[model samples]
Target chain A: MDRVGTVGIVGVGLIGATIGLALRQRAVAGQVVGVDIDAQAIAAAREIGALDAGGSDLDALRPADLVVVAVPPDDVVSTAVQAAAVMKRGSILTDVASTKAEIVRALDERLAGRVRYIGGHPMAGSEGRGARMADPALLSGRPFLLTPTDRTDPAAVSMMTEVAERLGMLPVLLSPDDHDDLVAQVSHLPYLMAVAVVGAATDRAIGIGGPAFAGLGRIARGPVELWVQICRSNRAAIRRSLGQFRRELDRLERALEGEEPLEILLQRSRRRAPVDGVPLDKPPR
Target chain B: MDRVGTVGIVGVGLIGATIGLALRQRAVAGQVVGVDIDAQAIAAAREIGALDAGGSDLDALRPADLVVVAVPPDDVVSTAVQAAAVMKRGSILTDVASTKAEIVRALDERLAGRVRYIGGHPMAGSEGRGARMADPALLSGRPFLLTPTDRTDPAAVSMMTEVAERLGMLPVLLSPDDHDDLVAQVSHLPYLMAVAVVGAATDRAIGIGGPAFAGLGRIARGPVELWVQICRSNRAAIRRSLGQFRRELDRLERALEGEEPLEILLQRSRRRAPVDGVPLDKPPR
Candidate 1:
C-alpha cells in the first residue's frame, strides 16, 4: 500500500473484515472497497468502517490498484480469478487462503501473465466466524505467510510484504508446498484430530467432558461447512498429516501394549510445553 | 470425616497437598498428616499450610482415622497395601489414584475383611506439580469418582462420600470398569493423543506451533515420569482408547479421501465446546 491508492477486498467475512479494518485503521489504503456475496456481511463491514464503500457485486473490485481475496479455500481460486479480471491491468491480486498450493496452481494456470497473484495466509483465526467477530488488531504481531510460486511477480510480492508489515504483521516467505505441508500438520490435522477425539468419546464421557478433552476438542466446534471445504481442498496433505499422527500413535500404542516405557515419546512431546508466544498454548474460543 | 479425627495423606504432591489443604480448611479432619518420599515436598506442604504435620516415614500414616493413598497409579496399590497394613484395623483407607479397576482389584484381594478400602479419584488437576501448586479449592465443585465393589464396607463408602462432599466435590458412583472406560477415552487417551500430535509435528510445524496445535498438544508438556507410570499402569484401557481414536480418525480420513462431507462429525464434536469446569483450558504453569 506504499504507493497504491485504492484497495479492493472480496468476501468480507471474518478474515476479510479484519484485514479491511486493520488496513483502514493504519491508513494503508486511500480508499477501500468491500465486496461480499452476503449483503449483510458487506453492510456490516461498511458499518464498522472496515470499508469506505461496499457492494454486493464482483464488479465492485474494478477500481482498486490492489485486490485481496479473503475467501475460504474452496472459493479462493474463483474469487482470485474474478478479482484478477476486475482489477486494473497492472494491479496485483492476492488471496488469504489456508491452503496455498492449489490456489497458486490455479492462478498459475489461469492468470499467470494476464495478472500477477501471491498466496497469503495469516496464521491466525478463532473458532468464531463472521464479520461480527472482526477486530482491527486481529493480525497484529501475527505471522502472515506469503507463498509465491516462480510465476508470481517479485515486485508484487515485495509490495504485499510492505502492506503486511504496515498492517502490523510479520510477512514470512514460504513456497506453496512448504506452507501447505506445514499447516496440514500444525493446523488442519489438529482440527480434524480434535473432531476425532470428541467423536471417540462414549456417551457418558461426552456428558462428563472434562477440561483436557474439552480443550483438546474445542476447534472441532468451528464452522463445519467451511472445514468441510478445507478438508476437501487439502485432502491429500491433511490425510498425510493424519497418517503421521496414526503412525506416531501406533508406535506409542505398541510400546504401551508391550508394557514398554513411554519415556522417549513423552520426552519428545515435552518440547511443546507451555512456551509463551505459542498460539497453541492459548487457542481462541 | 464426621467421626474421623485425623487424615493421613501419603505422597504429598499437588493432588495430595490440595486434598490436605481442602480437608483442613473444611475442618473435615482434626489433624492432617502428610507423608512423602520427597522431604522437600513434606516441608513445602507444611510451609503452605496444606499439612498440619509432616513426615517422610511410612509409619506416619498409622495414627489416622482415614489413610488416603495419593501416590502415582503404578504405586497406588503398593502404597495402599502399606497404608492399609499400618493403619488401625477399623480405620478406612481410600486412594486418590486415577485407575480404579486395578486398585480396587488389589484392595479386594489384600484388604478384604481385614481392612476396609474405598477406591477414590478426584477428577480435577492442573499440569503443575508439587505442594507449591496445591489449591484448597482444587476439587471444589468437581467430580470425584468412587469405585466400590460389593465387598466394600457401606459405612466406609458413605463416610468417604461425606468427606468428598466436605471438600466441595460431587461424588459420582462408578464401577471400576465404567470408571476405567470413561477415563481411558475421556482423559487418558486425550493426553496420549496430545503426545502423539506433538510427536507427529514436523520440525517446521513444531517451530511454528500455532494455538490450535499447541492447545491440543498442551498435556504433552506435563511431567513425563508420572505420565509414564500412568501409561504403564493403565496400559490396557489406554490402548483400547487409542484404538477407538484410531478407528474414528481413520473414518474421518476415509471421508476426506472420498471427498465426503464432514458435517456430521463436525456437529458431533461441537458438543465439546468451551466449558468453565475444564482445567485443560487453564493449565497450571
Candidate 2:
C-alpha cells in the first residue's frame, strides 16, 4: 500500500510492456525491472524503455515492492509462484492473465500468506500481439477486474487498485468463479464464434467481406497456442455459453422455416432498446 | 445507356432516401422522384431535399428514366412488378434488395424484355433505418454487387454500374446464386451469429463485454421484421453456412478437450500474417 518503491514486471509481452509504460509515465515506482526467459525479449524490452533494467534473472525482482506476472496463460501459474518465492515478503504480487478461476485457485492454493497475491485481468487487448504492438494508450480508459477471495491481503488489493487507476483503468471487484463465468459468456464466446465463422469460410467468401464481416471475425486470427490454453482452462463455462447459443440459433432457424411470430422472438432486444417507448413496428415518419 | 433523364426511387425508406440524396448530389437525373406507399415517408424524404418531388402513388414514377426499388424483402418482388407496369419501356429498372435470385426470377418471369430490370445490392447500411438517418454520403466508398444472368440486359447493367460509381461505390459482378452463397458465409451468417450470442446472453454478461463482444453482436440490433425476412428468403444458403460453422466449432472444441497440435489448426492464420512470418511462439524481440 506504500506508493510502490519498485515495480518488477515478468514477461514483457504486450500487457506487460503496456503496464511498464504506464508505470513509467506515472513515476509510481523508484525503479522498474523487466524479466523474460526469452533472452532476446529482455533486450527488446530494454531498447523500448519498458524497463529501467532488463535481464533473464528472477532474483532481480527480489527488491521490487510490486511484481506483475504478465506471461502467457499456460505459464502464468508457475511464473506467478516463482515471483512469489523470490520477491520480498509482504510485497504484493499479481498477474494479468485472462482466465482467472483456475489461476486464482492455483495461486491461492500455493502462495497465500507467503506473498500477497491478488489476481487481475485487464479487458483491453489488440488483435495484434507482442510488445511491438504495445502502447501506453492501449490501457487508457479500459476496465480491469480484480479477483480477491477471503484469503487475499486487503492492503495488497488496495495497492493493486491504485496501480490500476494510475494506468487509467477502472477496477472492478469479483470472485474468481464469477469472473470466469462472466468473461466466458462475453469475451471467450465471441472469439470462439469468430474462429468458427472464419474456419468454415473459403477465400472467395472472404474476398467479398467488408466492415461487417471483418469486424465480426477479427479475433479469430489470435495465436492458436494462446487461445488453446485459454479455452481449455475455462472449458465448462465456455461449453455452457455455446450450448445456449446453439439453442438460440435453432430457434431462429425454426422461425425462418415457419410463420413464427417475429415480435415475440425480438421481445428481448426491444427491452434493451435505446429508443423511447416507440414501437419498432411503427417506422419513422 | 442514357444519363438518367429522371431518376425514380421507390420505398423512400433508408436505402431509397439515401439513393435520392446521391442522385441529387451528382445531378445525374433531370429530377429525382420519390414514391412510397406510406404518405409520411414521402414527406420526410422531400423535407430532407432527398427528393425533388415526392408522392404516395406508383404513377408518380411514370416519367422516370430509371427506377430503383429499395423496399423490404417481402415486398421487393411485388413492388418491382408494380414499377415495371407503370414505368415506360426501355426505362431501366433495378431493385436494391439484399437477396437477388428470387426477385430477379420474379422480374424475368413478369417483365423480361418489357422493361430492363437488374438486381443491385449495396454493402452499406446503418443500424439506424429510415429517411431521418439518410445521408448523401451513406453510399460513398461502398461496394455494390450487380447480379445478372444470361437474360439480363447489358445496357441496364452498365447504367447501374455508372450510377454506383457516381455515388462513389465499386460495382462488382456476381451471379445471383453466387452472391447469395458468398454473403451467406460472410454477412448473413455473422448476423445470425451475433443474434444468437446476444440473444442468449444475460444482462450481467453484456455489462462486462469488451470490443469483441460489442462488435460481434452489434448488428443483432437490426430491425426484427427485416432480418426475419432476410433469413427466411435466403434460408438454404444460411442453413448451409450455419451447419458448416457448427461442425467447425465442434472441431475446435475437441481440440481444446484433447492433446491436439494447435499449430496445424492455426496454419491458415500464419500464412495470412500481417507480421514478418515470425512464429507467434517467439515473442517479439
Which candidate leads in TM-score?
Answer: 1
Model 1 bad stretches (over 4 Å): A1-5, A25-32, A46-49, A58-63, A113-115, A136-141, A259-261, A272-285, B1-4, B25-30, B58-63, B113-115, B136-140, B259-261, B271-285
lDDT, residue B27, candidate 1: 84
Q: Which lDDT tens digits does candidate 2 get at residues A16-35?
A: 88888778877877788999
Worst 10 residues of 1 chain B by lDDT: B276-285
- Would you list the C-alpha lDDT of every candidate in the order shown? 0.80, 0.79
- Where model 2 places Cα greater than 4 Å from the true spot, the runs are A26-31, A37-53, A259-263, A267-285, B24-30, B37-50, B55-57, B135-141, B259-263, B266-285
User: Highest DockQ among the candidates is held by which one?
Assistant: 1
lDDT of 1 by residue, A1-285 (tens): 354688899988889999888888888989899998889998888888899999888788788878889887888877788778777787888888888888889888898766777888987777558787888666777788999888889978988999989988888899998988888988888888778887787666765556687676566667787888877888788878887887888788777876555787677677654353352333212
Predicted complex 1: DockQ: 0.43
TM-score of each: 0.89, 0.87
Please give the RMSD of candidate 2 to the true structure.
5.3
- Tens-place lDDT per residue, model 2, B42-148, is 99999988999988889988898899999998998888888888888888888888887777878877878678888989877876688978987767776798997
